[model samples]
Target: MSQLILHHYPRSPFSEKVRTLLGFKGLRWTSVIIPAIMPKPDVIALTGGYRKTPLLQIGADIYCDTALIADVLERLAPTPTLYPAESAGLARIQAQWADSTLFWTAIAYSFQPAGLQSIFGNLPPEHLKAFMADRAAFRANAPRMRVPEAIGALRLYLEQLEAQLADDRPWLLGKATSLADFSVYHPLWYIRQAAGVAGILESYPHLTAWMERVQALGHGTSEKMESGEAVALAASSTPVSTEGEAFLDLHGLARGERVTVAATDYGVDPVEGALVLSRPNELAVRRVDARAGEVVVHFPRLGFQVQKVE
Candidate 1:
């Protein structure tokens, strides 16, 4: 197997999820720190256009979205599974809700005035301004939660978690930690990323305890790789599998058809290429980049919708 290369910035919550998974799997990986905002030229070189943080690079294949990244890691190392077998379906459903719903609420509450000041107090004026503007644009179309409403919702969610943990189990579902634990950890991790908001955890003893357990799974083995080196690695290696498990034919579209792929959420940039793979879980588009050579960017089927762009 080729060296696993993760392109991410430290402050990204989703990236933290991947990093923790890396630690849990005990997989050695290469890190390529990327900018937190747009104009990720080097990253676009490999991904064609999708600009989400914490992209997973395995040789010439680039996996976008943390949900898919988790799947890939689980497939690679199944022993310490992120998805538990006893209630696998339930675990997956809960994880999905946590990743999308719980996460946004946490962010909404975490970025309140006090937390924002703590996060940017030390930064230069221009840097802080840039970050704010960048995030605003990133979440342009997303709905905003009022601070009071956000706090109430978050508190309710925390109480529910407390009830789950009260069962005398270490994990949310059962004895072993599963995807549910990791999914819930990252957003709250973000809220607490700033010192001021971290104190709020004291209100929920069970939630805090579970958080400690999640943090213990460190980024197992990793060496920093420069952005340029990561791009070169993508340019040099060939993708292992263009074909995945299942396919959905549309508009009479076939494997060799010329199509475009893009995420349904933020960073709506599209990648145009020869459609190489479309499985029930993901879609792979083979695109040729002059600087990065040929690379295949894979997207989880759940968060993305595909079409034939004429």
Candidate 2:
């Protein structure tokens, strides 16, 4: 089997979520540090035009989105599961809310003036300006929450989360650790990057202890790998065939036809390829590139839209 390789930057909270999950599963992975913003040429060569951070590449299969990554990891390592059977549905719902709602609110609250200084204070002025410009364009489609509104919503959400820990439960859902815990924990984890913003969490003792528990899981064993080497590895291998598997048919595009898939919310760059796998859990597109050769890129079915290419 191809060894797990994670392409991510240190500061990305979603990457931290995957890292923590790797630690939880006790799985080793190869790390390929990626640029936080655009100019992700190596990533684009493999994923066509999808430029999200923290992609999981195994041989020629590139997995985008942490939601799908969690499922892939679960399949690889069954025990100590992120989704306990009884609460699996609820777990996914909670995780989705955390990844979207809670995440945006926490980002708004954490990127205030003081938090901004903590995160980008040392950057050269031009570099900082460039970063801001890139982000503004990236988020052009989504309306941002005002800092004041986000602060209020975050505190309210934290109150509810703190109450979940009232009976000394170790996780957010109930007895077992679920994807919900990791999803919620990551944004809070990002908040702690800035002391001024993280101070808000000090009020909740139970929440603080729980955050410590999550942090203690640590990133699993990893060795650094160059981005060039990862691309070359893809060039040397062929995408695994997904034949005779149960599939989804909501997309009207004919089988093997060229299509474009893209995130509906942001990072709207489209990836064009032949529809290779159209299953309930994932959407895979087979595309060939000069550098990465032929590779099948995968994205979670949720939050992504499929458009038939003319």
lDDT score, candidate 1: 0.85
Q: In angstroms, how far off is 158's CA in candidate 2?
A: 0.7
TM-score of each: 0.96, 0.98
Error of 1 at 29 (Å): 0.7
- Cα lDDT, all candidates: 0.85, 0.91
Q: Residue 310's C-alpha lDDT in candidate 1?
A: 79
Model 2 poorest 10 in a row by lDDT: 245-254
**lDDT tens digits by residue: candidate 2, 1-310:** 3599999999899999999999999899999998988888899999999987789999999999999999999999988999899889999999999999998998899889898888888899888889889888888779899999988999999999999898899888888988988999999999999777789999999999999999998888999999999999999998888777666779677678899999999888899999988878899999999999999999999999999988
Instruction: Count backbone clashes in candidate 2.
Output: 0
Model 2 gets an lDDT of 0.91
- In the order shown, what is each candidate's alpha-carbon RMSD? 1.5, 1.0
What TM-score does model 1 achieve against the real structure?
0.96
Off by over 4 Å in 2: none
Off by over 4 Å in 1: 243-246
